[model samples]
Target chain A: MLLIDDLHASIGDSEILHGVSLEVPDGEIHAVMGPNGSGKSTLAHVLAGRDPYEVTGGRVIYDGVDLLAMAPEERAAAGVFLAFQQPVEIPGVPTMYFLRTALNAQRRARGEEELGPVEFLALVDTKRRLVDMERALLDRAVNDGFSGGERKRNEILQMLILEPRLAVLDETDSGLDIDALRVVADGVTTLRGPDRSALLITHHQRLLEHLVPDRVHVLAGGRIVRSGGPDLAVELEAHGYATLDSPAVEPRTASAGTASIGTISTGTISTGTISTGTISTGTISTGTISTGTAR
Target chain B: MTAMTRPATARRPPSGTGVGMGVQVPERAREPEWLNAARRQAVAWVDANGFPSTKHEDWRYTKLDSVLALPLAASSGRGAEDGPGSVSSSDLPTPQLGVPRIVVVNGGMVPELSTLGTSLPGGVRVESMAGAVRRPEGRFQQLWTRRLGGYPHALRALNDAEALDAVVIDLPARTVVEDPIEVVFVSMPTGDARWSHPRLIVVAGARASATLVETYLSVAGAPSVTNALTQVELGTEAELVHYVLQGERTDSFHFSSLEGHLAEGSRLSSRLLATGGRIGRHEVDVVLAGEGSQVDLDGLFLTGAGQHHDNPVLVEHAAPGCTSRQLYKGVVTSDGHGVFNGHLVVRPGADGTDAVQVNKNLLLSERAEVDTRPRLEINADDVACSHGAAVGRLDPEALFYLRSRGVPEREARAVLVSGFAHEILERFGSGPIRRHAEELAAAAGLIVLDEDHCSSGAVTAGTVHPGRGGRAQ
Candidate 1:
């Protein structure tokens, strides 16, 4: 369902991914493994259509539409999801309120009937218990004051709720303990279906052992030098990046759309304080008390 | 004291004869020598300052033609000869628990309706301002005279000179009172112009605690003008929660000045609900005296149909480790106007101090208006402080959200506006006071929460579903 040709991208003036390409057929898992600066995160951010990252040269195709031709929110409504490497905090807005708003926003875009509070609350209740998150956490501001593991767990909960068709898991297992790792891995496993495809981006072979990938690609110097089965993760983890293809050899897709694109943007918020002011006065900063229009 | 020698800038006397008739500051006799001297000085200063007009910032959006045009003189009022009419507490509030309260009628203290608390904490002294002056209260002479007159308030200084009666309470160290102390002011007006000034000085010793409630009550058919000054003092670790409710007569004008000092680690929470009077002005000044002290200042005002209410408040944090918060809300309708000016000052060297001030207003009519400003002055770099003022319509989106949920339009508007004022109500800390304000707002015709005003399920998220806001939540 997802196809990426020789993609070359860059954030700003500098290029990150030279020419890297990959594809995930229906109902399959593809894992991208790389060293510290191999652009593992760059790929995920590029796919989600994060701005500031100039797609200097490349084309990305998902299903039959050009994935690059949509806004970030449009991509979201189109079923493209990217689990952040670091969840952000948004203060003031309650978790439940934000979730419902987002769900409705997507549903409206899709022209689907929105769910009522009763139905929405019921769905959230079932999902909360599935990830062992208490209802109190959902009721409080999103990700505010949450521990490292809790934020990761909350991300999984959102992933489950959004139910994207093409899910990109970026460093989802970084801060998890043994128990949390299994829970996260289990969430991913349960989400897999015949019509959905997922791309796992990771640095360690440890998480690979849990959510085993059907195909593995070794990334180095902004290029995917080699490809192998799940064993490739174990090999790269133990031996490192010495076997990267020579300079003469082309990395992958030569077209511009699917590359790392130099820079990246976008982050999540826990909650937001809407403290809005809608005074109908003419000027905001310098209006005289003459009219006292604020009243 | 006469109006001719008074400063040219002082407020012009109400045109012709004011609603107070023609009575001005009254000249008294047989009064103590010191009391008479202060009044002369006050009336002179007022003549100089003159009542401010729309041309001035503080009075912006507030009209003074009818107010300034009144023909007021130098005297408060001729006690017996000049009389607007007769009024009583019965004309104001419903009778209460025969808890005898000292009633001040037409600027005169009527001890006939007063009594000493049956069970008073030892060292707790409560009496009239005149009574204290008569007996000297044994307080150091320098402490009372020097500080009071050295920086006397223009109007207060004048009121002090001619004022007839007041309430004073002094609690000794470590004394904690179990019952509330109430002071009722009933204005009985006569003649053209009448002014009543009730001054209170409350001193709480170190570690002492007390709750003082001062209520302003005016009867029907009696139109008058009242100017009251109340002061509070706290010792180290002492606590005080003072509340004031203004329910004066319809034709009356009310002005009060509240000044309090909070000592080391001491705390104070002061709230006022001003829903009466054609024109009302309340000014509160709170000074944080010692380290680790905190103050909660809240005021809620509702005005309708030609009524004007103004609250000018200040909270000063002087020492390190002190905190203060202020929230003021107002709901205005008809051609009424509301003004809220809050000032928060954090002095230098006062580190670790946190201060926040906010003012919110809801205008129920296109003709009605509100002017809100939260001013913050911080000189210390190590502390945190902020102030914000917002005046807006009800949240259309939230309104829609509530409507789609089965709430009717009118009922939803009422509910939404009520929620807008909820924060201040919660801090009012008085159940009866809160309910009274809500009922007053509804009765003024700003909203109709009654069953007939709203249809069940009139509020829905989507079309045919609920509120007028676009799209569903």
Candidate 2:
């Protein structure tokens, strides 16, 4: 359903994503795990068509259409949704009003009949129960003065209403408590179907426990270094991302079983050094990843 | 009576022409001695000062060149060729709030057109200004003599001198009138260019509470001008809510001055909405005379195309422990000009005073202009005072958010502009008035959107006062 081929993007003078290649077939859930500054959020923003991120190279194909060529609203109409890391606060605009406008807009763009107020309200009531959103929150301004957990739940509510073909969750579990995480996870899990696919971007494997993924890819040095089953998330959580940086690492295919671990060379890589370190390593691996043969 | 064919140069009105041309005045010999003397003094004052020009600081942004050159005449009390006799109920600017309405046509009270239910509370007196002036006794005498003291502007003086008939509303001590008293000033200009000076005096005794709505509307298109003045006095612990709605013709001019004095523990809230006229200026002066008195002044002006609107508000915290707040917002589009000048003065020894003033404007077109000035003069050592003014376009982020949701660009811009004006409209305490304000704001938003999308239609074509004939100017 989604194909990202050697997508090289940058913001200003710094290139965040270099020759990153990944793909998620229909009816499957894929998780992209990386440490801080691993281009996890950058990849999500680029896919959502945020203007600040300049896509310098490569193309993204979704449902046999050029995704990069479409505007953000067009992408939304074409069934691509991005649950932002931090939902923007739009003052003076009621949540229900905003949601109704958005839902009708996307529907209209797709040549579908728009929903009337009564019908939209009924649909919103049904979806509100799925995420346990407070009834009062619907009347308040969109995400204005909302707590961290409410914003995430609101995002899920939108996802349920839009019912997009592909969903991208960026750090959805970062600021959530245990209860909120479970609620968000339940919302996402309910949307899983044969025709719908999701790309979950996170640093922790805890979210994976609730919404298990069919494929887990470790995005390091701006490239997918390894691909495996859900077990990769458990491995990364057990021994951090330090072990994934070893030389002569084998690229595990999506259907591969447990692979042998290489000998560890314990070298202290200080915190805050990953951003610059990953850029240098990414430059070296650009030649190979650009061929679209990394996955 | 000659029609104003084109913009006239700056010139003075005919000399010795009693302010407003003395069109509807009764015999001078029949007037009370004190009232006649007062009028003579006011006329003298106006003739001495003449009409204010751009050289004056208060009238700097609002030019009176074309307005002064019009053949200014006062309306005869009888219905003119172009008058409210032709104005239907649907032509009114705001929705009928079912209040006790007093309709004044051509500067005189229309008793047949007005409706004051028999259930009016005791100690409440609503009478014509001419009637009140004839009976020179107690409260009415005191209020008439103290007509907007201290601020001697030219137009106000003119209104005082030529005022043939005015509205006098007096509420005695502890009288609480549940129904609002609405004063509707309908200006209908005949072929000759005319001006009307309507005076309104409201006195709320100690612990008295009332709501007053003053609506200025022109039903005719003749080049007419309205220079209105309203004086309000709130006694100790008294509360009054005043609302002014101006919807004159685009070719005409409207100028209004409202002066309010609040006594100890008194509370006054005033709101002004200007959405009409080629040249509109509203000047509000509020004085917190006693300790613990409070004042709130909120205004919204929406101008488009060749329209120019100005609001100059001056609030004085004269006593200790007094508080005042002012918020004025404007939306100007397509060569429209808006001006907001707010002055907050905390008098000497008026310690413990708290004052805040904010002026924000939105320009929807490249040619739209706004001048916002907030002047804070604090003399007290122990006081909290702050003033801020901002003039800019709509928030691009807010616009993008709405557009990203698939709302058309024009619709998105309209929504954002409505939101900006809603902040001030919502401050109105009355439900019907607030709803009326919302309607005006929506109309203004549509006008802005239409201007943005199409260049052919003129902005002033969408008049707030619908179903009106005769094009002023």
lDDT for each residue of candidate 2 in A174-263, tens digit (9 for 90 to 100):
979998899878877888999999999998999999999999998765667788999999999999987887442333211222111111
TM-score of each: 0.56, 0.83
Task: State each model's CA lDDT, in order.
Answer: 0.64, 0.74
lDDT of 2 by residue, B1-473 (tens): 11111211223455432344332222255457767777777766665566676777777788777876676566644333234455445556555665678777657676656777676788688888656765646566677677533445767866766676778888999999887788888776644637777778898999999988888888756867888888999999999988888877777789899989999999999988888889989999988999999998999999887999999998999999999999998878777898997888999989999999998887777777788778999888999999888777766556555554555455456656665665667676537766665556555543222211112112222322111111111
Worst 10 residues of 1 chain B by lDDT: B1-10
lDDT of 1 at A55: 74
Given candidate 2, what's the lDDT at residue B99? 60
Q: What is candidate 2's TM-score against the reference?
A: 0.83
Q: Tens-digit lDDT track for model 1 on A1-295?
A: 7777777777534456777788888888888887655777878877877654667666788877888777665677777777777765543335665566556656766888877777888888888777889888876655779888888888778777778788888888887898778777877888899988888888888788898988998766566777889988888777876555446233332123223222222121112211123222222222211121111
Indicate the docking level reached by candidate 2.
Answer: incorrect
Candidate 2 chain A minimal-lDDT segment of 10 residues: A256-265
Give the runs in model 1 whose Cα sits over 4 Å from its true position. Answer: A1-295, B1-30, B54-57, B61-63, B71-89, B92-100, B137-154, B430-473
